[model samples]
Target: MHKFHLSIAALAGASVIALAAPVQAQDTAAQAPDAANSDIIVTAQRKQEKVTEVPISITVANQAQLERQQVNTMNDLNRIAPSLEIQQAPGQNTGGGGSIRGIGTQTFSAGAVASVGVVVDQVSQGNANISDLFDVSRIEVLKGPQGTLFGLTTSAGVINITTNAPDFHAFSARVRGELSDAGTAGSKFGNQVLQGVVNLPLASNAAIRVSGVANMRQGVNRNLTTGDLNDNDRYGVRARLLWEPADKLTVNLIGDYARARAENGGDFFTFIKTSTGVGSEIANCGLVAREGNQNYCTSQSYVGHTENYGGSLQIDYQAEPFTLTSITALRRSTETGYSAASNVFRADPLALQVANGPVNRHLSLFTQEFRISSPSDQFFEYTAGAFYSRQKQTRDPETLSVMLTLFPGMTIPLVDPATTGAGANDKIVDESLAFFGQGTFHLSPGLRLIAGGRYTTDRLSLDRYNYATAVASNTVLNVGNFSWKLGAQYDLARNAMVYATASRGFKGGQIATPSAPAVPFVVLPEIPTAYEAGLKTTLFGGWVADLSLFYQKIKDFQAQQCTVDSNSVISCVQRNIDGVKSRGAEINFFGKVFDGLSLNTGFIYAKATYPTGFVGTDGTVIGGTQLAYAPKYKFTLSGEYEVPVTSRFNGFLAVDTVWKSRIRYEANSRSETTFRPHWLVGGRIGVRTEDDRYSLSVFGRNLFNVHEPSLIQSDFPFGGAANIGAIYGPQSFRQVGLSFDAKF
Candidate 1:
């Protein structure tokens, strides 16, 4: 079937399932109803507000929903939010990124800036690290441009995470642990997690909170050489302090540290022979192995380790009708890893012996911001802010080694003292300054107008040195840009609001490292303009629904291309495309269907394509093709039921299912690297004490053992005859687990 038709079928199926649930009559005799679908508070606009009151297309998940859904990491969010997708890069061990609304970074270069920004407690991070999700209170996903309010400029959207704050009048502690098995022979303790949090009142007006987590898991894939692959061992801790010296003055300090050491599931190859006379040297290897079977056959190991630490300070002061705030932060991250190159050379005789060397990277960043805002109750409320940030990154030297096994007992090195052990030392530094302001004017009692603008200046520098020849290259770039938003909103009724907005977002110009010395070193920035209209409504007293439609056009979209020269040396380059267009519609509904039953459903339909004149890396015309990782239709349906088991205990059950259409992994739209439509189901059943202090539950994820590939890559055209294979990462297998929680 055509891809478009498949998308339509999937959407139809999801709609039927969502609307067919029998709506049970409300039971007045039931106990206190479940509050899971109650009004949720979100900070999408840099201020607290009910999610139903926000004009943007936003999704908010609280602690209760997160626990019931078993969402432990950022990657798990795709199951609930259909507009987002996350995947690991094909060949790299420490380079993976995500996309929002069909727009994101296509390359894994350290110098490439992300279209989506991730913020934690008002502090922006350079990368989308999953460790920051530990012990989070709530997560809010905002769709569309957000440059006018946030310190970081994002063309796609923003993810805002808020952690629990210290309470001066409370002393509490909580602990939770989980243990799971993969339901396969030779697989023991597939997953384990232990987490704890403590809150204490140090003085009359001062308080402190601390949180820690330890997570470990065994691999889903078994390596023929090594025992297991894709294992995870991670630990993290966070501390926060709050002090209120006066009624109008408040200060907060936060620090966090996280470390991970594990073996990454590097790319596994499946051979594809283009020529018919190539003998039995190539065979069809499924992207994902069947149940109870290993997928990859390799001789070398792929391992990675990472360390991250950060701290931030915030101060707020209230003066009459205005408030002033300041935030200062610093962070550092280091990663080291290596992946074998044998997967790309499956057709050669010495394919199993080649391997790439270790890769090391370090990043350090500092940021500061100051802001002032008028009270929200005023007729003309306004906010203004200034931001400054500096970042430095370094890539350590790397080495490539080849092993020769001529005669079992005798082997010699085929090495040239100088060029055989070549490496590159690269460094990048960036500094940015921006000033932004937003204001809302009440045109009338039921109508409002909003306008905002931001101006940013960025300075970037790059230095590269070759160890073999002592050759060096240096480049610098400076650019300035402006972005703005215009919006209007109207209150139609007591429980309905409609809004429309048009916004522009910008990304800084980048310094591209080209293989050819004659090419320029700089690629201009990309800008996107988006127009959106949305409606939010609360119906039937407890049912909330939202609908949004958006259209975006991006100019000078960045694209990466690779070519093989006459000497068979591959050279990759980055350039700007003419333009791209994306239009989509999102629908969300959440509320209590009956006294003890709640339902949450989300659906997304998007069509993202490139304009005419777009070219692929292998000289193929890719005009009118779908963007990478952009699916046409996606949907999620989740339902939960809560009932009283006893006077002091409550029993609850939750089940959720997610479905996504086929997605292309590369711009060329090759069929071999496309992820077909798939579905996943998860559920939990448990009982908890009436006081909510103690609980136990049994849960299962991927209950049907679906074999789907998360990412797929084809190296047939880029590597010529030497590399003609496909690599992919399969989804996790079925897992069943039990969890225990306690509070004091």
Candidate 2:
């Protein structure tokens, strides 16, 4: 806690230093004319427009900035955007534990969908969302309800990712490699990354671009029982082809495959406390982690693997008065292996062994979209689109309980007993269709009125069979909703804009297949009504600043709640809460203050909670409780400065820091499920050529070795005192490495 307090002071000092440098920077402004570009083109509105000119709150990070900050995964992104939090829950290969403005899906059910959508290129992702940020052009984070333009999943917001397209005019290739070590703190060359991109010019009007990446890292936590934990290896390759079949038509074809494997690392387990007694565990948490061993299983090795592959095609044609576009995509994601953390909730385990049988899951998705747009220059500008999506999911039976043990008085692992047959198979299919449109009516040269809406229909079916009881469950549910937006934006000046909007967003109802006979097969959809106001402006040379305030109320909020019956049987499913409220303010600033110094900062003050008058069947009081993963306040700051050394080379330094208030992993506000406020800091120092053709740098992450978890849970099945389970962040330990980059 002291360290966290010190970090705040440190960041305050840094800000003071930054405030003091502008005066000196003004004197050297003439010598450093290459400042930041204040105006950046974006597709926030489904059409191209300057980011600051848009009426929504947004944060943009380009490839150079991402690489400079060493942001390679979803968790790393949370530090750059205060309003976003990516939690990779243990044993889950897919990216589902993510929230925008403290609203997201937290269930581990294979069929559950996230409220915050992730869009790659122009294709919306289902269960196959990519986990690695490899070879991307830029990322745009849009806050607030984007359902009118993004579709059913984006009730809260959207993470829009656009990769580099094939450059028909260029034939070039480049490769980058990085290696880092933490000595006794970590493995030798514990983290390594290699990635490359190649552009091939084919016919006169056609080209293809291929990019691939391989990243391997050793787990920072040690399993005092045996070897290190959470060792991971991931690799993937992406290929895109751009072809202009005719003078007025363009086509893009894309395909990619990626795979990740890890040992007892899929879940973060640190010893928080044990139900048994004190001095009993040094490190214990996450379902029941014991001292000295993160996974702490002696029976069978814990391992898991996840694979994702997909293909998409996009065609665009320019007509006389409008543009026509079509997008089609198919994606499949699979996970197979045993997850120790997954089973710990069903039984009191003497050691770590998730299930009696290997856990396997498969997800398939198909999407089609068509859109038409008129030029933005028109007085009445408009965009309209139709979208269709289908998803199929299946999970193999997992043996949740067994009597197998390695020792007499100790439960080391699982081995199914012949006397009992336990497990079940789950299958689900979901389909959705929607039509959406948005338009702007120009009232005058400096003012415009905007309106948009989406009409969607959804259907879901599920089948689950229990082996022991021979009980089968078959269910189907259908739902429909319409969401809309009303707003107005005004240009205060050439470099400033102000806007206010009232919007309604919808998240489709949820369906799940329980172990045997499903009690609640469907959950009603959630509807959020929101009012927001914001201002975007440019100041101090090329610096850009934005301030926004919002309030939202949601009815029938969906959340995952679990229970254990008297028979020692656990039933986990999606449940709808009475009401949810979110109100907050945000500030974002990015760009150069002057000369060679640049700063990027984002802060969020959000109060997300469930209102009073709501009680649980288990007698758990949750009235006025904050939602899980929703921190009351968060702040992120990063800065970089360039020092001119000579005509041929220059030296530079960069630093970043993130601080978040205390958060609970469960909406019930349980005492055991809490992560104290914490801070993370990173730095880099390097030398580069004046023309920027080549450069080398030394970087360090988690400079303070802050060990903090992104998620926490109660040891549900335990009998003694309250026990906590936690999964730490990706950069939980200190790591320093060397990096090299070249362009030719």
Candidate 3:
């Protein structure tokens, strides 16, 4: 395997280098200029500049890269970015976790927060509600801490994706089709999709661009008894309008909706009692049983429909070297489906059973921001902004319970209402206001300094009332904090620069758990400080390389702890008790190595540890443990070559690989073994027309058929000790499919 990987790497490198070689033939006099020499522009610092000239560590995947690499969603981006990871929930209530540099939340709760922030066209996507894949122009990932420009939510940096804009000079249309085969564990899962887009010029200065997509995929699992269905069909669509009435103002109205009615049928675990038979090993909050079936796991399924609609109005006006902009946006989402596990009935064969049910949630938000920036002069460049937002989220009724039959001599124990209660609902309201300013100053011809700070005020109110259980509570809290950043850069040569920076970042304090009537309660807020140094260089006018090392310390880290009280109502305690220290290094390189070829690679080494304490399910304190879902080492490399076939036809081939060390789930606080280490390799072969007007391509992903589970666990007893009943979807297997894309 080592030799195989080395050979592939060598071939890819050679191909890329060949792409950059000067053309030797005058045969086709009609050939276009080499694409590699075009200047790449980016907006990493809230301003447009050459990508290679940006001081911060950044990665950009433009439209050409996306089309060549076949990147469609967050998951595709994950496979290529060594510093990032994305995973769906394993089963019900499993937290959806994404990690960057070994730091992130590992909870499936709607209220949980993610470590890295995702921003779409300047708007922060606070949650996964808007995570659907879409047609985009570019994706930019700024590594390390992003306090000065992105704010507190960016303690672990930021991912910004920008979509294509309407063109007034061109009237065009395109269509695409895809057929895919995926899954592992000897299962057959198929996926199909169709997409189309049109750009129309309504008038000289106004245009409209609209796109729609429909996709369907089948799951690998099947119900034992029903034989009916478990994992099956899912689909969605998006319509957008971009209107520019004048040169200074633009309005974009977007409406997109997605629905999945397929069986949520994923893998899950059942509990087995310890030798003492005092407690079960399962971690779910509650359990229930239906008919007589000894230890048979209950069937799990998912059925839900979600709708997302929003509008962004942006106004930009420039006067001399100063520019002012205003942005207004709104988003709303509602999801209703089951949020329970089926392990209860599977573990207790004699226990009465209950079918799965719904866990409904609705969220609404409105945000506005105004900013002014002055173009860089001989002396200074400055940017200042003010932002405000209002959000509301509601969770309706999450309940489960069971009735057990006892032996003749055994007595039935009384159950707590908190555990089997009905009409349990949660409501949260969040409002924030902030003002920030940053400036860059050139002290000498080759030296630059930057300083910035932000002051923010946040307020939150939460209410949880279980009407049927007669339990209710409400709380409100307000917090104010100031974060700052400072950096200095010195150029060592025309194509190389060295820099050092220090920044303070934070995550907003969360609402206290309403039902936890503890001795002393407070909102858990996270304050992290980061220090970093790095080198940026451009080689051969084609390759861009960046290397950075960083250390971050977080105080009062917020995490959820499940505590079983005598009343049986599991208390979700939120506390600001623990502290975490993290350190890591990252290296990124992208360039053309040869004629008609491109290469991109990244490496990351990160480690995170809890310095204070973490609470266990049994109410025991565990100290000095590693955080879950974070790998210690990760790397990725990809390269592609384009081959000319005819004046109207072109062909291309590409290979990409990712490798990472093992990661622990549940923060390794529990004694369970949940995951293993793995590596993945994929390749693509396709052809496109010279003008890029019409194309047909065949591609294969996960060519090695590796079972690199994104999430794993060892608590399901049905599969036995060594097996521990793992609940994971096979990442993807060797798939060969042909795609057709046309433009008119």
Writing each residue's lDDT as its tens digit, candidate 3 over 548-584 gives: 8989888886665533344323344565645687788
lDDT of 2 by residue, 398-423 (tens): 76653434555765323342213366
Ranking by lDDT: 2, 1, 3
Which structure is stronger by lDDT: 1 or 3?
1
TM-score per prediction, in order, is 0.86, 0.89, 0.83
lDDT of 1 by residue, 474-520 (tens): 88889899999999989998788899999999877677754323423
Clashes found in each candidate (C-alpha, N, C closer than 3 A):
0, 11, 25
By TM-score rank, best first, the candidates go 2, 1, 3
C-alpha positional error of residue 57 in candidate 3 after TM-score superposition, expressed in Å:
2.1
| TM-score, predicted candidate 3 vs. hidden true structure | 0.83
Residue 177, model 2: lDDT of 59
